[model samples]
Target: MTITPAQVRSALLARREIAIIDVRDEAPFAAAHPLFAAQIPLARIAVEAPWRLPRKDVTIAVYDDGEGLAGQAVAQLRELGFTRVEELEGGLGGWRAAGYELFEDVNSYSKAFGELVEHRRGTPSLPAGDVQALIDEKADIAILDARRFEEYATMSIPTGRSVPGAELVLRAPVAAPDPDTTIIVNCAGRTRSIIGAQSLINAGLPNRVFALRNGTIGWTLAGQHLEHGRQESIEVGDGVDEARARAREVAYRAGVRRIDAGQLADLEAESHRTLYRFDVRQPDVYAAGHLSGFRNAPGGQLVQETDHFAPVRGARIVLADDLGPRADMTASWLAQLGWDVLVLEGGFDGDLATGSDGAPPPRGPEGRYKRPYEGTDNPAAAMQAYLDWEYGLVAQLERDGTHGFFVI
Candidate 1:
């Protein structure tokens, strides 16, 4: 079957259940995809699609940028038991030709919306050079690596502490006890950094806050040094514990549940029930060493994209995080979105496998992803033009009246 862009747009506008799959590589998909599309590269269809889109008969539409990949993907999906699979008419190029907005960057629309927030509200920011210099000087800066603990341990600015995304609100006061100290948040790329910084800002903190400019990718691109195997002691205080408890209550309000490791094991043992477990950390962290069966789905995008993360619509989901904030925060969003989401108990605290530390060495450069927004030879003008379009997205979100997003 073939689905037109207009029909897809209408389905999106009506809030219908349509899995708009972009069967392009990570790069182009990140460069641009339809506003509501989720990426499942054609190469990964046989392995990823069934788990991602578990409902065999759901309305699934696939697209590629005029390269005929979508047609190929539809055939593969059908063979894989996707009973209602269809290709997007004209593919991604057709959708673009229909004049619908295409979002860019990883979780592009959300990050673009965040940039728009910064543009409009002057969301605080710190330059990578300045933050790096402060770290070098050992100044009173609390560098919060907001991706996840494992991501922090994988490679981080020398002075960074692993503060996974959800824990910012709960751990902030303790991590930056000196009200005079500057607090900076970072992630592999942008979304978590923006959301983490804004989270602290919204909580009315006494300390100054800023997002690490462009996150870890920005730090790497700026020719900064990253440290690995540097472990720091973290102490959760009474105040922080109380804050975390309060955050849990907030999550309960949002519909999050807590389950122990044993229950998770029991659930995973059920062969008939499909369970999706996400470490809810950065990709680097997942590579470093995560729950044996869990995949990488960084907290911010996971919550922003519940449907893509757990396409079964009603599948049981277990999230793991050493720091509680991210799991609670993400589970809260999932519950509100009507998913059966729970945060797993117990943190992963073993040593590195490759190192004497007993932790497995992080997956190397081979595992690092090249974002779609970047181009090997694409001109500077196109990049700038792309940013200009992304810059106007928040206002468009308001006009379109979709997203169902509210600043927390």
Candidate 2:
């Protein structure tokens, strides 16, 4: 069986449960792939397929760029008991030949959505040089690093604290109590920074908020020094109540729906609709105790890498967090990004499951893609190319015309 690009596009528009998978390695897949295509690399099919496409009969379409991997992938999937696997009619070349668009880089659609958000909202930002000047002058600005703690520890702006994206709305009050203090958000590159800064702004924080334009990349390009091994992090203390109220309000304004335990069960009962249940709390908290059948996907990273977590574009997502603020805030962004997202309401005390938090096992280094936005040594040309691609995303999305993303 072979599926055409037009059929795949129709499936996406209809919000059907179809997985258009690229069976090539990371590099080439990153170079170009359909907007909704997920990279499952043929080498890691056995490890990723079973969990990624959990339903045995879910529609699965595999494609490659004339590398002849799709046939093998379809055969392997069938052997693994997948009942609805097929090859892409034209492969990668075929999709291009059929006049379909191909997106670049990992998490392409999510990054493109971020670009759309910025374009639509005109999110405020400060260039790296201006931010550095404020730091030198000891200005009353709180620089929040929106990347993971590990990434922040590797290298961060001189005095930036590790607040990671989803935690921004919940911790911003605690980090910068003064309404007059300017808050600057930075990530390794653009998406998280744009989302984080916009998150605080959307939550209606009293402080002036701005994305550190181009994030750490811009800082590096500006020849500013970065701190290594920094341990600064936000502590949720006296402001928890306020944070919860603010976060819930933000979520409400973004059109997110709240579902109790019974409703969630009902959603689960709908076997025909693909549902992703995620505990959007920190890893340590999730590892300590999480709801049964829920996987640990920290909210910030979930928003940053939606394509990896929920490749089924139109699937329903339920976010769980013991503290309501995180889930509510995370769900707000997801809703704006066009996900059918719901926040699970109530205490976290049903059949609590604890341990590794249900994350899929990691693939070996051989299957991993070296991201151009990571590390300090990425070539200047590569970094510039990345920014160029991001700058063009809003236009690309306009041309694609299939993304249902809306800014609130």
Candidate 3:
């Protein structure tokens, strides 16, 4: 079968669960690609297909950089057991010809959505230049890399410390003591930065918080350097612990529900439709400890970009947050947006094991499907306009009249 770029665009807009594979070499693929396309070079197709795409029935669309690689790769994928493989008509060239914006770098959509969130919600951010000055002087600025620990280990800002996305709520206080040190949160790209920074601001922390503008993207573009060695383990204090407890209470106040392991199993078994469970914690934390049958989706982005993560729109979403604030906040938004969202309680204390079978199931491969807005520079006008809308969301939430959400 052959699918046109228009058809692909429409399918994505409609939230169809199709795997978009860009069958081009790394260099060409890196030059430019769609916001949501995952780059798996045609050479690696056979080896990576069964793993990156475990589901044989998922509709797969393969595209090349104007070359005829797509058609050949599609055939190979079908031959190798992908039941519904098809070539994108006109290839990646066709997609660009259709006038859809091509996004570069990684996690573009999440990054773009981060920019959009800041634009729409007036989410505050700190300039990278100013942040660098603080670091240069060895000032009291705390640069928190809010990505997974593995990502931080791979690459990070020189003065930054690794604080996985999920730990932001509980660890933010410990990271900044006087409430006077500037706390800037960043991810490899944008969504986590916005979500992480906004998380602290939303939770009513005493410290002044801001997202690193454009995250590491801006950092790189500005000709800045990064640190590659192991990050020192941060010590948490009783104050931070108290703050976490209070944050959990706030989450409860915001209408989050908690279900035990048995109840979770009941929910899974009772539902006739397929349900997607998520551990709304950092990927590293998830790798270390998580409930069986749960996928990792850090909290802020889950709420910010619900359609990508839970494309079904109507699927039951059960989130597990070791820190209740993140889970509660995420569920509250998902519920408002018409998803049947729930929070699984008491699942991740490191000491607690979830599955009734006693041994934990092997974890699934992490979702590597890239989002849209990763690398392109945004125009100032568009960004400011986006932030304006986001600024009033709280009041809009009040006016939205969809307060079926309970705090927990």
TM-score of each: 0.69, 0.97, 0.66
Candidate 2, residues 1-408, lDDT tens digits: the string is: 888888888988887778889999888888899898899888888888877776777788899999889999999999999888889997988889988788999999889988988998999999999999999999999999999999999999999999988888878888889999999999988999999998888888999999999988888888778888999999776777787898899899889999998999999888777888899888888888889888888999999888788776778999998878889888998998878999999758666888875445777778567876787788887887888989999999888877888888
TM-score of 1: 0.69
List, residue by residue over 203-299, the lDDT tens digit for candidate 3.
7788888888867666766667767765744544566456556555555555556778788888777534446788776555667777666777777
lDDT for model 2, please. 0.87
- Model with the higher lDDT, candidate 1 or 3: 1
Where does model 2 exceed 4 Å of error? Answer: none
Better of 2 and 3 by lDDT: 2
Which rank order by TM-score, best down to worst? 2, 1, 3
For candidate 2, report its TM-score.
0.97
Q: What are the lDDT scores of the predictions, listed in order?
A: 0.68, 0.87, 0.65
> Which candidate should be chosen as best, given lDDT against the real structure?
2
Q: Sort by lDDT, best first: what order?
A: 2, 1, 3
lDDT (0-100) at residue 367 of candidate 1?
A: 20
Candidate 3 TM-score versus the reference: 0.66
